[model samples]
Target: MLTQEDNTLLTRTGPGTAMGALFRRFWQPVALSRELPEPDGPPMRLKILGEDLRAFRSTDGTVGLVSPRCPHRGADLFYGRNERNGIRCVYHGWKFGTDGRCQELPTMDSGPAREKAEQNVRLNAYPTREANGFIWSYLGPPGQVPPFPELEFTTVPPSHTYVSKKLQQCNWAQACEGGLDTAHFSFLHMALDDGEDATAKLLTKVSSNTDTVRWMRNDGAPRFTILDHAAGLILGAARRGDPNENYWRISQFLMPNHGLTPNAFPGENYHGQCWVPIDDVSCWIYNYTWNPDRPLSNAERDRFANGSGIHAEVDAHYIPIRRRENEYLLDRNKQKYETYTGIDGVSEQDACIQDSQGLIADRTTEHLGPTDMGIIRFRRLILDSAKALAAGDPPRALNHPAAYKVRGGGAVAPATQSLPEVLQARFGT
Candidate 1:
């Protein structure tokens, strides 16, 4: 458990905060690429890391992330007209380009005086990159911006990937730690009193192998082995399997706030999530399911679109249909008869519990055990990185962009085999 001071250091990520500074150094997904479906489309209202911003797709198809308020008269850019190649504030006909520099200030005549005022009066803008259905922006010191981590999902063909984002109404750290804490899968995702095939029935869409489900159900207490790497940590949890074999669920925790789930088998879809903080109390969980081997089929895509695995069924605004206001639509009868939590979807179950940990979990009051090793290391990594950045040192993950290409999945190996050997046998890393 963290002390009160350490907990504060971990949760608060507003501007000027140590954690916020560390997050800003890395590229963050500010909006989905599809949000601004076309050039000169409406701008998106964004509030990331406690900063109000706006995102727009320019005529060249490049994305722009800038302060929402027009510097001219403090008018909100959400009401601005996206015309030509820039956002023109209707308040006074002030046009700002994707770079946030005033492109045209109609209030002043087009002359040396106008040019000087236009150049001097500009909105705060950050750099943006569009890849794999996301509009990512770098919001740190211009000199300190690192190369984007080429996450495997973003590198795949568009047809092979399905990306979505849902509002997670809780602190970013707790939701993130939930992803790294694979031990909860044994209970949180289990179907209670549903006979011998209960586990299989519940996780059929998540894990193709029924035996893997059985292993997860039988061994609630998985032995963990964590390995540190350039991008983040490789968390390996081993559960007892049939005979001499052990079922290993290996996951990846990338940098400050990304987690790759371990449910995929060879030829199956790989899944990951990025918890980009909207504020200290909430975050947008950007989720992706990608097949590295081939394109996703229409049926598979439809299933995901309707809510399956990590994908939640969200409304047009990207808010989950089953959310906090509705108590995640809990059904006690279903809890007693169907699944353990009475929650219909895996994503909803996760959200229901994480949000229950208060707006922010008070780590100072909790008890932690060995199974929480991944959670512990995750906190240590980011907390330490935050402190190190404060001391004028940068994180090592920023230097190894290619390391983000690594994958996480399940494997079956001898109980005597080490995690390294299992990783080799499964992924040939």
Candidate 2:
């Protein structure tokens, strides 16, 4: 549990806050690449880390993330025309390029005054890059931008990955903690009273095999072993399995707000999520699934698109179909017989519970246990980083970008094996 002061520092990430400053040191995804499908397309309004901005693709196919308000008369750039390698304000003929350079000031005559105004009147723009089907931007101070982390999904071919985002009506920290707390799988994502065969069938619908489901169901209290690495922490939860083997679910928690799931065995599609804060009480959960060995099949893509595993069935606006506004379409009868939460999708179930923890979870009035070691360590790591940043020391993860190339997954080993040995056996690190 945390004191109220610590919780405040952990949750609030607006501009000028210590947590916000720490997040600014890293690159953050602002929009999906498909959101700006064609060159010179319409600008999309984006709000990340409580800062309102606009994103557009230039004629050269490069993405531009700049201030949404025009510097001339505070007009919104969403209505501006994207053409000829720049965004032209519809209110006036002023045009700005992807680098925020004032290109043309047609309203002002081509005189000395016009040239000076064109040079001085520039919009604030952040550097952007497209990777892994997402448009990422560095919102920190100029010249201090760090290199992008070598996430495995972003390093793979487009055909080998699928990416999507959904809105979550809760604080980013709590939603992120839910992803790292793998011990909840035994109850939160399991069947209640369904027979073994029916439970296996339901689990299969969510992309898990019967062996994993059985191991999770049989061992509700998993022994945990955590290891600290350069980029982040490796969390391994060992559960009793068949005769001489222990089922190990290993997960990775990267700096800032990224978590790699532990459901995939070898050859299965790997999954991960990044909880980008939209504000103090809302967030956008970006989900990525990739198969490093080969390209994802059409059926697999279709299943992900229609809501399977971590992917939620989202509307055109990327909001989940069953959300807080509709009580997540909960069915009491289904809860009593079909599933534990009466939720149809695993992502929906996660959202439902995490949101139910209130806008920002009150850690001051909570009780934590062994299963919560991952959550505890996560809070410590981030809070310490935030404090260190406040003291003028940058996070070490920023300097070790290549360390982010690690992977996390499941494996079966002897109970005597150590966490490092388990990781070596599974990921060959």
Candidate 3:
């Protein structure tokens, strides 16, 4: 549990806050590439870290993330025209390029005064890069933009990767804690013991094998071992398997807000998520799945599109169909007789529980246990970094972006093997 002071420092991430300052140092995903599918397309309104912004794709395929207010008369830029490599305010024909440079001021006459105004007038713009189907923006100070972290999904070919986003109605920290806390899988994503046939069917949907499901269900209290690396931490949860085997579900927590799931085995697809704060009370969970070795099949792509694995069944606006307003379409009968949560999808089930923790979880009043070691370590890492930044020292993870190139998944190791041995054998580090 945290003190009230620590909880506030961790949860609140609006501009000028300690946590927000730390987040701005890293590039964040602002929107999916498909949001602005064409050049000179419609501008989209975006709010990240509690600041309202606008995003539009220019004629040359460059994405502009700029302040929404037009400087000329404070008109909302969302109503502007996106054309000819810039956004032109419809009210006064004042145009700004992707770099935020004023391109034209039609209201002014052509003279030295107009030239001076165009040279001095500018809009706040952040640098943007498109990769792995997402448009990422740097919101930090000028000339301090760090290199993009080499996330596996972004490094892979388009044919081998799939990405999607869903709105999570809660503080970003708790939703992120949900991803790092692998111990919850034993109960939160399990099936009721009605019969062997029913258990097998439900297990198939949750895991790659029934044996793994049995191991998770039988051993709810998995022993945890956390290893810190340059980029982040490796969280290993070991549960009892067969006579001499240990079922290790290893997940990765990278820097600020990324978590790689532990469901994959050798030759299987890998999954991950990035929890970006939309505000103090809400967030956007960006989900990605990739197969590094081969192209994903059409069937797999269709399944993901229809909400499989970490991806949610989102509507046209990327809002989960089963959300807080509808009580996640909960079914008490299914909860008692079928699955553990009676939730139709894994993503929905996760969102349901995380949001239930209140808009922002009150860690000060909660009790924690050994199973929460990963969560504890996560808080320490982020809190320490935020504090260090306040002391004029930036996080080391920001400087070592290449160190982010790590994998997280499952491995059946000998019960005697230590966490280091298991990681070495599985990832071959």
Candidate 4:
């Protein structure tokens, strides 16, 4: 169980809190590409990762994220009109651009007086960028925000990409942790289809001091080359005739509030989607369908649409605002959705497990060992750096880039496929 102090570290979104500080270091997705397909109308209101902000594309195709409330009378920016150049606040006719710089004060005389005041007062605006079919915003300190990583999935042809979204009620951290918990894949996504499946169990479990537990590639390869890690992370490069093998699986967490997991199909197809949080407790999972040539098979496409399979029923009853407080206080506390399957026969899959675990986990009480390496390291980075930022220190990952080589540090490669000989011998297909 997490103590009050532990909760303080995890739940607080102030400058130095564990999760908040960590999230501030990256450029997070604020909205989907379709949100601003055209440069028209009032700005779109979006709350991404955790911050409340407004977004809109310019007539010239540039997207901007700015403060939601007017710096003057505190009017909401969503109601403002989008002109060719900037957003004009209907409340006071104060106009501003994507840069958060005040461009005009219609009521004031058109003179240097208005220009001086506008120059002195600037509304907070976050840096915005678009990538992989999503609008991304950097909410952290400008200097510390890291460059987005260049994953191999993005290099594939546009025909391979696909998109989709789902709604959840939970904090961004709770949602993100699901992706890092590699143990759950075998249990949650239980290999109901893989031909050479090793993890078909109904439930997946692990411990810190793993001896009997095998964590390695079946080939007995070098530790660094194999997907052998305590964190349950399995990665490998693409191999010919492999089970949709590629340089990477394209599964990654955007930190704090969002994650991306790409699933590949047999027809040379791929789908990259994102799980975006609606608030501290609710999220919207989105999919960007990248496939342009071949259409998805019925079964393959259905897999993505099944709604976190066996988990949706439990999520229906979740009320984040009410349960948020008690979540952090209990251990072994199954989220309300974790156990609540609707009479219609559905179970809460990933969403319930994380949220019900606690709105915010008491990290100190977490018995993290190896399987949780990714999550553990991620949290530490978040808390420590957030603490540093709170202390007015520079943010970490300030020089983050989209593409960088991972040398000798033992990164996981994508999964491989069973040989044709084995398949023929076993099934005679």
Candidate 5:
């Protein structure tokens, strides 16, 4: 049970809070680097972690994240004038370079005296790195930024990836859980199966987690009694729900933020989920679909963009807002199922199920069951790990160079198979 202090810590968003500080330690994906055109405008406005910031890309394509407000009399830097290598405030014409150093002051005489003053002033800036088509911003101490995870899939050519964003009106935790909860796919997606004969088998397979149950925990926070490989079949949904024996699939959750579901077909058509936190009440879900060889036609893109593709069939579940009798039913249903669903299938297909939870699901009033083992353990992990980080004694990254194959192993193979197969076949699967 969580104490009053723990409960308060969970809800608060401050530097001292466990969650806030833990999140800062990570290099968060702020924006897509491609969003900034090479010859784009001077200063761009970006919002992350509930704070508005001013950013600019150098002519060389380097990005700089800095305080949105100018230091000299506090003008909006977003409106600043853009030069080749720096931005000049529109109000007072004070120029700041990519390094946050004041390069020029239009009002001051151009001489040694002006240079001396400019050298002493520097704008606040966060470290920025561009990788995997995204701009990651490190908000933690300069010395502690962890090495960015090497995502093998993202290493493919630029033409292989298609990206989109889903605006979610919920907390980051809610968005994160949408990916973490594996059991919802069986029911939430059952609507599609109910509507058409073609989808029934696929839906059944997705919902079926009848095999394999293992209890585990990470970071000393929560216990994870997961029904692994349950989500493997759902990856078929992206490829017209193919059930061929030769085909394979996987659903992987990269702890703390993203979800990856990959298809093992002739043409690699992969889907990913990125959770973007925007304060306590809202977040953004960034979706990416990567097809190595088969490029989606404009029509196909439109189908997804217009929500008429597989997304439509999957979204048909959930009660309409006006017809909902109880607001909490959906969340309770989710939490109840997530505890031991035997499989973690996609859950963000519908808003009704999540929105009906009334923003934050209250754990105090809910009943516990053996099946809820997964969610309970997961929550404990977050709470415990977050508390640890909140204290000065920070934990080490789970990546172990010696243990290699067991955890943080860099091997690329189907995750559905057992350890023996993983060892014997290695990359054969």
Candidate 6:
């Protein structure tokens, strides 16, 4: 368990906080690219790392993420007219370009004074890029921006991916830790068929085979092995399988906040999620599924779009239909007969439990065991990085962009094998 001080330090990520500074060093997803829809469309108001910002696409499809408060007279840019490549403040004819440069100071006289004002007045803006289906923004120090990490999902063809986002009503860290804690699958995502063959039909078929289901059902406390690398961590949870084999569920945790699910095997679809803070109390979970060798079928796309795997069935606003206030539409009968959660989707089951830990989990009171090794290591790595940044040392992951190109999934190995050997046999170095 963490001390209260460490717990507070771990959860609070607002501006001026060490944790927030660490987060700024990486590009963060603020919105899905499809949200803007077209060039010169509606400007989106967003809050990331506790700062209010606005985003708009220019005539050339360049997205501008700028402060929502217009520099002149402090008018809200949210009500601004998105026209001709800039947001024109409706309060005045004042306009700012996607780069945050003042385009027109029409309220002033067209002379030296107006020209000077246009050059000096500016709005806060962050560099943004579009990839996969996300609008990723860099909130770090200018002139020090690094290349975007080559997350495999972004490198794949658009046809090979399905992306969606849903609001998770809990702290980003807790929601993220939920993804890394694969041990929970034995109970949280477990169906009534512990010994039956029904649950063997893997939810997404990444971790398939009936023997795998029996292993998870029989072994609640999987032995944990953590491997640290340039990008972040490789978390392997090994459950007792038949005879002398170990069923390993391996997941990846990328620095700052990304998690690759351990459900996939070779030739199967892969899944991942990014937990971006909406604030200290809530976050947006961006979910994606990809097939490396081929384009996903229409039915697969429809399944993901309508809540399957990590994706949640969301309303028009991206808020999960079965969210915090509604108790996740939990049905008592389903809990008794169908599944342990009684929750509609895997994503919702995760949301329900994570949010139940409270808006911010009180880590100080928790009882952690060997099964929580991933969670413990995760906190240590991130907290250490945050503190190290405060002392003028940036994380090494920032420089090793290619190191992000790693996969995590299920691997069954002899019980005698070491973590590295298992990793090598499953995912070659």
**RMSD in order of candidates:** 1.0, 1.1, 1.0, 9.6, 8.8, 1.3
TM-score of 1: 0.98
Give the better candidate number (1 or 6) by lDDT. Answer: 1
TM-score of each: 0.98, 0.98, 0.98, 0.63, 0.70, 0.97
Question: Over the stretch 1-429, how does candidate 2's per-residue lDDT look in tens digits?
Answer: 999999999999899999989999999888889989999989999899999998899999999999998899989999999999999999977899999999988888889999899889999999999997989999987999998999999999999999999999999999999999999989888887555675787677644668988889999999888889878999999999898889999999999999999878888889999999999999999999999999999998998899987999999999999999999999999888878898878899999999999999999998999989999999999999999999999999998999888777889999889888988788888
Which lDDT tens digits does candidate 3 get at residues 1-429?
999999999999998999999999999999999999999999999999999999999999999999999999899999999999999999989999999999999999999999999999999999999998999999998999998999988998999999999999999999999999999888887777664565676555546677887888899999999999988999999999999999999999998999999878888898899999999999999988889999989988888889876889999999999999999999998898888898888899899999999999999988899999999999999999999998999999998888888788999999999999998899998
Candidate 1 C-alpha error for residue 102, in Å: 0.4
Runs in model 1 lying further than 4 Å from the true structure: 195-198
Candidate maximizing lDDT? 3
lDDT, candidate 6, at 168:
92
Across 219-289, the per-residue lDDT of candidate 1 in tens digits comes to 99898999999999999999999999899999999998999998888998999999999999999999999
True lDDT of residue 73, candidate 2: 92
Model 3 ranges with Cα > 4 A deviation: 195-199, 202-206
Task: Write the residue-wise lDDT of candidate 4 on 1-429 in tens digits.
Answer: 335664466556544345565556666566767668888655788776567788888777888788789888899989989997788889889988889899888778967887788887667888888766567777876665565644334444644544444455555555666754443443343322232222212222111211111222222221111232211222222212224432222233433333333223223333333455555556655544434355545664454344322223122222221223443222232222332211111123455466666655555566654445556554555455566766777443344343221111111233443322222332232
Backbone clashes for every candidate come to: 0, 0, 0, 40, 10, 1
Report how far residue 300 has shifted in candidate 2, in Å. Answer: 0.6
Pitting candidate 3 against candidate 6, the one with the higher lDDT is: 3
Best-to-worst ranking by lDDT: 3, 1, 2, 6, 5, 4
Query: Which residue segments of model 4 deviate by more than 4 Å?
Result: 1-7, 14-18, 143-145, 191-279, 282-348, 362-429
| Model 2 whole-model lDDT (C-alpha atoms) | 0.91
Whole-model Cα lDDT of every candidate shown, in order: 0.91, 0.91, 0.92, 0.49, 0.52, 0.90
